[model samples]
Target: MRVGGSEYQFTGTQSHPYWFGWESMTTENPSVVLQWKSEGTGEQHQQNYPVILQVGGGLLHIWYISPGEVWNKVGTAPFSARAWHKVELGIFARPDTTGWFQVYVDGQLVADARNARTWDDRGNKPRWGVYDSKIATADQTHWINGLKLGTSRADVD
Candidate 1:
Protein backbone atom coordinates (compact mmCIF):
# COMPACT_ATOMS: atom_id res chain seq x y z
CA MET A 1 0.00 0.00 0.00
CA ARG A 2 1.09 3.57 -0.66
CA VAL A 3 1.94 5.31 2.59
CA GLY A 4 1.60 9.05 2.02
CA GLY A 5 -1.00 8.75 -0.69
CA SER A 6 -3.44 6.71 1.39
CA GLU A 7 -5.15 6.99 4.77
CA TYR A 8 -4.43 4.53 7.57
CA GLN A 9 -7.09 2.14 8.70
CA PHE A 10 -6.68 3.29 12.30
CA THR A 11 -5.50 6.59 13.75
CA GLY A 12 -4.82 5.68 17.35
CA THR A 13 -6.06 8.58 19.39
CA GLN A 14 -6.15 8.69 23.18
CA SER A 15 -9.41 6.73 23.08
CA HIS A 16 -7.71 3.84 21.22
CA PRO A 17 -4.06 2.82 21.35
CA TYR A 18 -3.54 -0.91 20.79
CA TRP A 19 -2.21 -1.86 17.31
CA PHE A 20 -1.60 -5.13 15.44
CA GLY A 21 -1.68 -6.50 11.91
CA TRP A 22 -0.60 -9.10 9.35
CA GLU A 23 1.47 -7.79 6.46
CA SER A 24 3.39 -8.97 3.40
CA MET A 25 5.76 -6.92 1.36
CA THR A 26 6.50 -7.60 -2.28
CA THR A 27 9.84 -5.93 -2.02
CA GLU A 28 12.61 -6.66 0.46
CA ASN A 29 13.16 -2.93 0.84
CA PRO A 30 12.81 -1.34 4.25
CA SER A 31 9.29 -0.26 5.19
CA VAL A 32 7.42 0.92 8.25
CA VAL A 33 4.85 -1.44 9.70
CA LEU A 34 3.59 0.93 12.37
CA GLN A 35 4.41 4.25 13.99
CA TRP A 36 3.14 6.40 16.91
CA LYS A 37 4.01 9.94 17.93
CA SER A 38 3.48 11.74 21.19
CA GLU A 39 0.88 14.46 21.24
CA GLY A 40 3.36 16.72 22.96
CA THR A 41 4.53 20.04 21.58
CA GLY A 42 7.00 18.54 19.12
CA GLU A 43 4.88 15.48 18.46
CA GLN A 44 7.97 13.63 19.51
CA HIS A 45 7.72 10.40 17.57
CA GLN A 46 7.74 7.77 20.28
CA GLN A 47 7.92 4.35 18.59
CA ASN A 48 7.90 2.63 15.20
CA TYR A 49 9.42 -0.58 13.82
CA PRO A 50 10.60 -0.58 10.24
CA VAL A 51 11.00 -4.16 9.02
CA ILE A 52 14.39 -4.61 7.36
CA LEU A 53 14.01 -7.56 4.98
CA GLN A 54 17.17 -7.29 2.95
CA VAL A 55 19.07 -10.55 2.65
CA GLY A 56 21.59 -10.99 5.46
CA GLY A 57 19.87 -7.95 6.96
CA GLY A 58 16.55 -9.25 8.20
CA LEU A 59 15.94 -7.43 11.45
CA LEU A 60 13.03 -5.99 13.42
CA HIS A 61 14.10 -2.50 14.41
CA ILE A 62 12.14 -0.85 17.17
CA TRP A 63 12.71 2.88 16.63
CA TYR A 64 12.33 5.19 19.61
CA ILE A 65 13.51 8.56 20.88
CA SER A 66 13.34 9.58 24.49
CA PRO A 67 16.38 11.48 25.82
CA GLY A 68 17.98 10.67 22.44
CA GLU A 69 17.13 8.85 19.20
CA VAL A 70 17.77 5.11 19.03
CA TRP A 71 16.81 2.15 16.89
CA ASN A 72 16.59 -1.05 18.90
CA LYS A 73 16.79 -4.25 16.88
CA VAL A 74 15.50 -6.89 19.20
CA GLY A 75 15.03 -9.57 16.57
CA THR A 76 16.69 -10.75 13.39
CA ALA A 77 15.54 -13.15 10.68
CA PRO A 78 15.59 -13.20 6.90
CA PHE A 79 12.18 -12.35 5.48
CA SER A 80 10.88 -13.94 2.31
CA ALA A 81 9.11 -11.72 -0.13
CA ARG A 82 5.32 -12.11 -0.36
CA ALA A 83 5.15 -14.14 2.81
CA TRP A 84 2.53 -13.27 5.39
CA HIS A 85 3.83 -12.17 8.77
CA LYS A 86 2.19 -11.07 11.97
CA VAL A 87 2.96 -8.07 14.20
CA GLU A 88 1.50 -6.73 17.41
CA LEU A 89 2.24 -3.59 19.45
CA GLY A 90 0.69 -2.46 22.74
CA ILE A 91 1.09 0.92 24.37
CA PHE A 92 -0.28 2.68 27.41
CA ALA A 93 -2.52 5.64 26.85
CA ARG A 94 -0.57 7.78 29.25
CA PRO A 95 3.17 8.28 29.57
CA ASP A 96 4.86 6.13 32.21
CA THR A 97 7.91 3.96 32.63
CA THR A 98 5.81 0.78 32.88
CA GLY A 99 4.92 0.51 29.19
CA TRP A 100 5.98 -2.48 27.04
CA PHE A 101 6.32 -3.70 23.42
CA GLN A 102 6.83 -6.99 21.56
CA VAL A 103 7.16 -8.43 18.03
CA TYR A 104 6.20 -11.76 16.45
CA VAL A 105 6.59 -13.17 12.94
CA ASP A 106 4.86 -16.34 11.77
CA GLY A 107 3.76 -16.82 15.38
CA GLN A 108 7.34 -16.73 16.61
CA LEU A 109 8.68 -14.24 19.12
CA VAL A 110 11.30 -12.39 17.15
CA ALA A 111 11.71 -9.36 19.40
CA ASP A 112 10.55 -8.80 22.96
CA ALA A 113 11.51 -5.57 24.68
CA ARG A 114 10.07 -3.71 27.61
CA ASN A 115 10.58 -0.38 29.30
CA ALA A 116 9.12 1.87 31.97
CA ARG A 117 7.69 4.18 29.34
CA THR A 118 5.95 3.25 26.07
CA TRP A 119 5.05 6.81 25.21
CA ASP A 120 5.96 10.35 26.10
CA ASP A 121 3.87 12.81 28.09
CA ARG A 122 0.42 13.49 26.68
CA GLY A 123 -1.88 11.12 24.78
CA ASN A 124 -0.34 8.62 22.36
CA LYS A 125 -1.69 6.41 19.58
CA PRO A 126 -0.88 4.53 16.37
CA ARG A 127 -0.59 5.32 12.67
CA TRP A 128 -0.58 1.79 11.29
CA GLY A 129 0.45 1.26 7.64
CA VAL A 130 3.22 0.09 5.34
CA TYR A 131 5.19 3.31 5.12
CA ASP A 132 7.27 3.26 1.94
CA SER A 133 10.46 4.70 3.41
CA LYS A 134 12.31 4.14 0.10
CA ILE A 135 15.50 3.42 1.94
CA ALA A 136 16.38 0.67 -0.56
CA THR A 137 14.00 1.50 -3.37
CA ALA A 138 11.58 4.30 -4.17
CA ASP A 139 7.83 3.75 -4.39
CA GLN A 140 7.59 0.41 -2.67
CA THR A 141 4.32 -1.43 -2.06
CA HIS A 142 3.05 -3.71 0.72
CA TRP A 143 -0.04 -5.76 1.49
CA ILE A 144 -1.74 -5.58 4.88
CA ASN A 145 -4.71 -7.39 6.34
CA GLY A 146 -6.23 -8.42 9.67
CA LEU A 147 -5.36 -5.02 11.12
CA LYS A 148 -6.78 -4.59 14.61
CA LEU A 149 -6.55 -2.94 18.01
CA GLY A 150 -7.99 -3.90 21.35
CA THR A 151 -7.54 -4.07 25.11
CA SER A 152 -5.97 -7.53 24.92
CA ARG A 153 -3.79 -9.54 22.55
CA ALA A 154 -6.53 -11.99 21.70
CA ASP A 155 -8.63 -9.12 20.40
CA VAL A 156 -6.12 -8.47 17.64
CA ASP A 157 -4.89 -12.03 17.13
Candidate 2:
Protein backbone atom coordinates (compact mmCIF):
# COMPACT_ATOMS: atom_id res chain seq x y z
CA MET A 1 0.00 0.00 0.00
CA ARG A 2 1.06 3.62 -0.65
CA VAL A 3 1.68 5.80 2.45
CA GLY A 4 2.76 9.35 1.86
CA GLY A 5 1.47 12.89 1.49
CA SER A 6 2.25 16.39 2.61
CA GLU A 7 1.44 15.38 6.17
CA TYR A 8 4.00 12.60 6.10
CA GLN A 9 6.76 14.34 4.21
CA PHE A 10 10.07 14.85 5.96
CA THR A 11 11.52 18.27 6.43
CA GLY A 12 15.03 19.42 7.30
CA THR A 13 16.65 16.88 9.61
CA GLN A 14 13.31 15.46 10.68
CA SER A 15 13.06 11.92 12.03
CA HIS A 16 10.24 9.51 12.75
CA PRO A 17 9.59 6.07 14.14
CA TYR A 18 7.09 3.58 12.76
CA TRP A 19 5.67 0.32 14.04
CA PHE A 20 4.05 -2.56 12.18
CA GLY A 21 3.05 -6.15 12.73
CA TRP A 22 4.16 -8.76 10.22
CA GLU A 23 3.63 -12.48 9.78
CA SER A 24 5.06 -14.59 7.02
CA MET A 25 4.28 -18.15 6.11
CA THR A 26 6.75 -18.53 3.31
CA THR A 27 10.49 -18.81 3.57
CA GLU A 28 11.04 -16.95 0.35
CA ASN A 29 14.46 -15.36 0.20
CA PRO A 30 14.68 -11.63 -0.42
CA SER A 31 10.98 -10.96 0.03
CA VAL A 32 10.74 -7.27 0.67
CA VAL A 33 7.91 -6.33 3.03
CA LEU A 34 8.52 -2.62 3.30
CA GLN A 35 10.48 0.06 1.48
CA TRP A 36 11.21 3.79 1.53
CA LYS A 37 11.84 5.16 -1.93
CA SER A 38 12.47 8.56 -3.43
CA GLU A 39 9.90 9.38 -6.09
CA GLY A 40 11.67 12.53 -7.22
CA THR A 41 14.21 12.42 -10.02
CA GLY A 42 17.91 13.22 -9.82
CA GLU A 43 21.17 11.37 -9.21
CA GLN A 44 20.79 7.65 -8.58
CA HIS A 45 17.30 7.93 -10.06
CA GLN A 46 17.43 4.37 -11.26
CA GLN A 47 18.81 3.02 -8.01
CA ASN A 48 16.92 0.82 -5.60
CA TYR A 49 14.99 2.18 -2.65
CA PRO A 50 17.07 3.94 -0.02
CA VAL A 51 15.69 1.70 2.73
CA ILE A 52 14.12 -1.74 2.68
CA LEU A 53 12.84 -4.31 5.21
CA GLN A 54 12.93 -7.79 3.84
CA VAL A 55 13.16 -11.44 4.79
CA GLY A 56 16.14 -13.46 3.64
CA GLY A 57 17.62 -16.70 5.01
CA GLY A 58 14.73 -16.80 7.49
CA LEU A 59 15.81 -13.54 9.10
CA LEU A 60 14.62 -9.95 9.02
CA HIS A 61 17.13 -7.68 7.32
CA ILE A 62 17.33 -3.91 7.21
CA TRP A 63 19.07 -2.49 4.14
CA TYR A 64 20.28 1.03 3.56
CA ILE A 65 21.33 2.42 0.20
CA SER A 66 23.70 5.34 0.20
CA PRO A 67 23.70 8.25 -2.22
CA GLY A 68 26.76 6.70 -3.89
CA GLU A 69 24.57 3.72 -4.89
CA VAL A 70 25.91 1.34 -2.31
CA TRP A 71 23.59 -1.21 -0.67
CA ASN A 72 24.53 -1.76 2.95
CA LYS A 73 23.08 -4.38 5.23
CA VAL A 74 22.70 -2.34 8.33
CA GLY A 75 20.98 -4.83 10.63
CA THR A 76 19.31 -8.21 10.92
CA ALA A 77 17.15 -10.19 13.40
CA PRO A 78 16.03 -13.76 13.65
CA PHE A 79 12.49 -14.21 12.41
CA SER A 80 10.17 -17.01 13.31
CA ALA A 81 7.85 -18.29 10.64
CA ARG A 82 4.07 -18.46 11.08
CA ALA A 83 4.02 -16.01 13.96
CA TRP A 84 3.11 -12.40 14.30
CA HIS A 85 6.04 -10.12 15.06
CA LYS A 86 6.12 -6.52 16.12
CA VAL A 87 8.70 -4.49 14.25
CA GLU A 88 9.61 -0.88 14.89
CA LEU A 89 11.89 1.20 12.70
CA GLY A 90 13.29 4.66 13.22
CA ILE A 91 15.09 6.66 10.55
CA PHE A 92 16.79 10.01 10.75
CA ALA A 93 16.41 11.38 7.26
CA ARG A 94 19.53 13.18 6.29
CA PRO A 95 21.57 13.25 3.12
CA ASP A 96 24.75 13.87 5.03
CA THR A 97 26.78 11.65 7.35
CA THR A 98 24.78 12.45 10.48
CA GLY A 99 21.73 10.32 9.76
CA TRP A 100 20.86 7.06 11.49
CA PHE A 101 18.75 3.91 11.13
CA GLN A 102 17.38 1.71 13.90
CA VAL A 103 15.34 -1.45 14.19
CA TYR A 104 13.54 -3.20 17.06
CA VAL A 105 11.89 -6.58 17.07
CA ASP A 106 9.46 -7.78 19.70
CA GLY A 107 10.35 -4.84 21.90
CA GLN A 108 14.03 -5.71 21.76
CA LEU A 109 16.61 -3.54 20.09
CA VAL A 110 18.05 -5.49 17.19
CA ALA A 111 19.93 -3.00 15.07
CA ASP A 112 21.19 0.47 15.73
CA ALA A 113 23.21 2.33 13.09
CA ARG A 114 24.60 5.75 13.78
CA ASN A 115 26.28 8.55 11.81
CA ALA A 116 25.41 7.47 8.30
CA ARG A 117 23.68 8.90 5.25
CA THR A 118 20.10 7.63 5.34
CA TRP A 119 18.32 9.75 2.79
CA ASP A 120 18.64 11.11 -0.71
CA ASP A 121 18.02 14.53 -2.27
CA ARG A 122 14.25 14.09 -2.11
CA GLY A 123 12.61 12.52 0.91
CA ASN A 124 11.71 8.86 0.91
CA LYS A 125 8.12 7.60 0.81
CA PRO A 126 6.84 4.46 2.47
CA ARG A 127 5.53 1.46 0.53
CA TRP A 128 4.28 -1.78 2.05
CA GLY A 129 3.58 -5.15 0.49
CA VAL A 130 5.25 -8.26 -0.79
CA TYR A 131 7.89 -6.97 -3.21
CA ASP A 132 8.82 -9.47 -5.85
CA SER A 133 12.31 -10.95 -5.79
CA LYS A 134 14.19 -12.00 -8.90
CA ILE A 135 16.04 -14.87 -7.25
CA ALA A 136 13.01 -16.16 -5.41
CA THR A 137 11.29 -18.95 -7.32
CA ALA A 138 8.45 -19.77 -4.95
CA ASP A 139 5.34 -17.73 -4.34
CA GLN A 140 5.29 -15.81 -1.09
CA THR A 141 2.48 -14.69 1.23
CA HIS A 142 2.65 -12.35 4.21
CA TRP A 143 0.42 -10.21 6.42
CA ILE A 144 0.99 -6.68 7.68
CA ASN A 145 -1.07 -4.96 10.33
CA GLY A 146 -1.11 -2.29 13.08
CA LEU A 147 0.99 0.28 11.30
CA LYS A 148 1.71 3.47 13.19
CA LEU A 149 3.93 6.53 12.82
CA GLY A 150 5.01 8.76 15.62
CA THR A 151 7.73 11.03 16.97
CA SER A 152 8.69 8.92 19.96
CA ARG A 153 9.03 5.31 20.95
CA ALA A 154 6.08 5.62 23.28
CA ASP A 155 3.91 6.77 20.41
CA VAL A 156 4.68 3.83 18.14
CA ASP A 157 5.97 1.09 20.39
Candidate 3:
Protein backbone atom coordinates (compact mmCIF):
# COMPACT_ATOMS: atom_id res chain seq x y z
CA MET A 1 0.00 0.00 0.00
CA ARG A 2 1.15 3.65 -0.70
CA VAL A 3 0.21 7.19 0.34
CA GLY A 4 1.14 10.87 -0.02
CA GLY A 5 2.42 10.42 -3.57
CA SER A 6 5.45 8.65 -2.02
CA GLU A 7 6.81 5.14 -2.65
CA TYR A 8 8.20 2.75 0.02
CA GLN A 9 8.99 -0.93 0.40
CA PHE A 10 9.69 -3.33 3.28
CA THR A 11 13.30 -4.25 2.67
CA GLY A 12 14.04 -5.93 5.99
CA THR A 13 13.22 -9.24 7.61
CA GLN A 14 9.62 -9.18 8.81
CA SER A 15 10.27 -11.16 12.00
CA HIS A 16 13.53 -9.82 13.36
CA PRO A 17 14.26 -6.45 14.91
CA TYR A 18 10.51 -6.16 14.66
CA TRP A 19 10.88 -5.42 10.95
CA PHE A 20 10.09 -1.79 10.16
CA GLY A 21 6.27 -1.80 10.16
CA TRP A 22 5.02 1.58 8.97
CA GLU A 23 4.02 3.74 5.97
CA SER A 24 6.01 5.67 3.37
CA MET A 25 5.08 8.70 1.25
CA THR A 26 6.65 10.68 -1.58
CA THR A 27 5.64 14.31 -1.33
CA GLU A 28 7.03 17.29 -3.20
CA ASN A 29 6.38 19.62 -0.30
CA PRO A 30 9.13 20.74 2.06
CA SER A 31 7.37 19.40 5.18
CA VAL A 32 4.49 17.18 6.26
CA VAL A 33 2.71 15.69 9.37
CA LEU A 34 0.78 12.44 10.05
CA GLN A 35 -1.55 11.26 12.86
CA TRP A 36 -2.44 7.65 13.65
CA LYS A 37 -3.88 5.26 16.26
CA SER A 38 -3.78 1.56 16.95
CA GLU A 39 -6.47 -0.38 15.08
CA GLY A 40 -6.51 -3.42 17.31
CA THR A 41 -3.88 -3.66 20.07
CA GLY A 42 -2.56 -1.04 22.49
CA GLU A 43 0.96 0.28 21.84
CA GLN A 44 2.57 -0.11 18.39
CA HIS A 45 5.66 0.88 16.51
CA GLN A 46 5.69 2.99 13.32
CA GLN A 47 8.96 3.26 11.40
CA ASN A 48 10.14 6.23 9.36
CA TYR A 49 10.98 6.09 5.64
CA PRO A 50 14.13 7.06 3.79
CA VAL A 51 14.24 10.43 2.00
CA ILE A 52 16.60 12.44 -0.15
CA LEU A 53 17.18 16.18 -0.06
CA GLN A 54 19.21 18.62 -2.08
CA VAL A 55 22.21 19.94 -0.18
CA GLY A 56 21.78 23.44 -1.57
CA GLY A 57 18.20 23.78 -0.40
CA GLY A 58 19.10 23.95 3.31
CA LEU A 59 15.50 22.91 3.92
CA LEU A 60 14.41 20.21 6.42
CA HIS A 61 11.19 18.22 6.66
CA ILE A 62 10.08 16.45 9.92
CA TRP A 63 8.05 13.23 10.29
CA TYR A 64 5.99 13.21 13.50
CA ILE A 65 3.91 10.12 14.45
CA SER A 66 2.35 10.24 17.87
CA PRO A 67 1.13 12.07 20.93
CA GLY A 68 0.55 8.79 22.74
CA GLU A 69 3.13 6.13 23.47
CA VAL A 70 4.91 4.62 20.48
CA TRP A 71 4.58 0.87 20.93
CA ASN A 72 6.82 0.57 24.03
CA LYS A 73 9.43 3.19 23.30
CA VAL A 74 7.32 5.99 24.72
CA GLY A 75 4.60 6.76 27.26
CA THR A 76 4.28 6.09 30.98
CA ALA A 77 0.51 6.06 31.46
CA PRO A 78 0.22 2.72 29.66
CA PHE A 79 -2.44 3.81 27.20
CA SER A 80 -4.90 1.37 25.70
CA ALA A 81 -4.40 0.15 22.17
CA ARG A 82 -8.09 -0.85 21.65
CA ALA A 83 -8.81 2.86 21.74
CA TRP A 84 -7.48 5.42 19.30
CA HIS A 85 -4.06 7.03 19.82
CA LYS A 86 -3.16 10.33 18.25
CA VAL A 87 0.25 10.80 16.54
CA GLU A 88 1.86 13.51 14.46
CA LEU A 89 5.08 12.90 12.44
CA GLY A 90 6.94 16.03 11.41
CA ILE A 91 9.83 16.34 8.93
CA PHE A 92 12.12 19.34 9.09
CA ALA A 93 14.86 20.58 6.75
CA ARG A 94 17.99 22.09 8.21
CA PRO A 95 19.08 25.68 7.76
CA ASP A 96 21.06 27.26 4.88
CA THR A 97 23.77 24.58 4.60
CA THR A 98 21.44 21.60 4.17
CA GLY A 99 23.52 19.15 6.17
CA TRP A 100 21.11 17.42 8.51
CA PHE A 101 17.46 16.33 8.85
CA GLN A 102 15.04 15.68 11.72
CA VAL A 103 12.24 13.27 12.68
CA TYR A 104 9.70 14.03 15.37
CA VAL A 105 6.79 11.98 16.63
CA ASP A 106 3.87 13.50 18.44
CA GLY A 107 5.30 16.67 20.04
CA GLN A 108 8.59 15.12 21.14
CA LEU A 109 11.74 15.53 19.12
CA VAL A 110 13.27 12.23 17.91
CA ALA A 111 16.45 12.66 15.94
CA ASP A 112 18.59 14.95 13.80
CA ALA A 113 21.18 13.22 11.64
CA ARG A 114 23.50 13.91 8.76
CA ASN A 115 22.81 10.39 7.46
CA ALA A 116 19.59 8.68 8.44
CA ARG A 117 19.25 4.88 8.56
CA THR A 118 15.50 4.54 8.20
CA TRP A 119 15.08 1.79 5.55
CA ASP A 120 17.43 3.18 2.87
CA ASP A 121 18.12 6.83 3.71
CA ARG A 122 18.79 7.96 0.14
CA GLY A 123 18.73 11.60 1.15
CA ASN A 124 15.79 12.33 -1.12
CA LYS A 125 14.17 15.61 -0.37
CA PRO A 126 10.41 16.42 -0.29
CA ARG A 127 9.62 12.75 0.53
CA TRP A 128 9.08 11.56 4.09
CA GLY A 129 6.52 9.49 6.04
CA VAL A 130 5.98 6.11 7.82
CA TYR A 131 6.46 2.59 6.38
CA ASP A 132 6.02 -0.46 8.57
CA SER A 133 5.16 -3.72 6.72
CA LYS A 134 6.13 -6.34 9.23
CA ILE A 135 3.70 -9.21 9.72
CA ALA A 136 4.56 -10.73 13.06
CA THR A 137 1.82 -12.27 15.21
CA ALA A 138 -1.67 -13.20 14.04
CA ASP A 139 -2.89 -9.87 15.40
CA GLN A 140 -0.14 -7.59 14.17
CA THR A 141 -0.44 -4.71 11.75
CA HIS A 142 0.43 -1.00 11.84
CA TRP A 143 -2.60 1.22 11.34
CA ILE A 144 -3.17 4.94 11.82
CA ASN A 145 -5.80 7.53 10.90
CA GLY A 146 -6.07 11.34 10.58
CA LEU A 147 -3.07 12.11 8.41
CA LYS A 148 -2.30 15.71 7.45
CA LEU A 149 0.48 17.65 5.64
CA GLY A 150 1.56 21.22 6.32
CA THR A 151 4.48 23.35 5.20
CA SER A 152 4.88 25.60 8.21
CA ARG A 153 3.18 26.27 11.55
CA ALA A 154 0.30 28.15 9.92
CA ASP A 155 -0.35 25.48 7.32
CA VAL A 156 -0.51 22.74 9.97
CA ASP A 157 -2.45 24.75 12.52
Candidate No. with top lDDT: 2
lDDT by residue (1-157, candidate 2, tens digit) is 3356444655436545343333334344568888877766665454347778888777988888776578788888888666678887777766677877778888788878787666666666667777857765666676767777776667676
Query: What lDDT tens digits, residue by residue, belong to model 3 across residues 75-146?
Result: 121123333333333333321222233443333444444422333222222332433323233332234454
TM-score winner between 2 and 3, please give it: 2
Model 3, stretches more than 4 Å misplaced? 1-83, 92-99, 114-137
Position 70, candidate 2: lDDT = 81
Task: Give the lowest summed-lDDT range of ten residues in model 3.
Answer: 13-22
Candidate 1 lDDT at 2 equals 33
Whole-model Cα lDDT per candidate?
0.52, 0.69, 0.29
- Sorting all predicted structures by TM-score, with the top scorer first, yields 2, 1, 3
**lDDT at residue 129 of model 2 (Cα atoms):** 72
Better of 2 and 3 by lDDT: 2
- lDDT preference between candidates 1 and 2, better one: 2
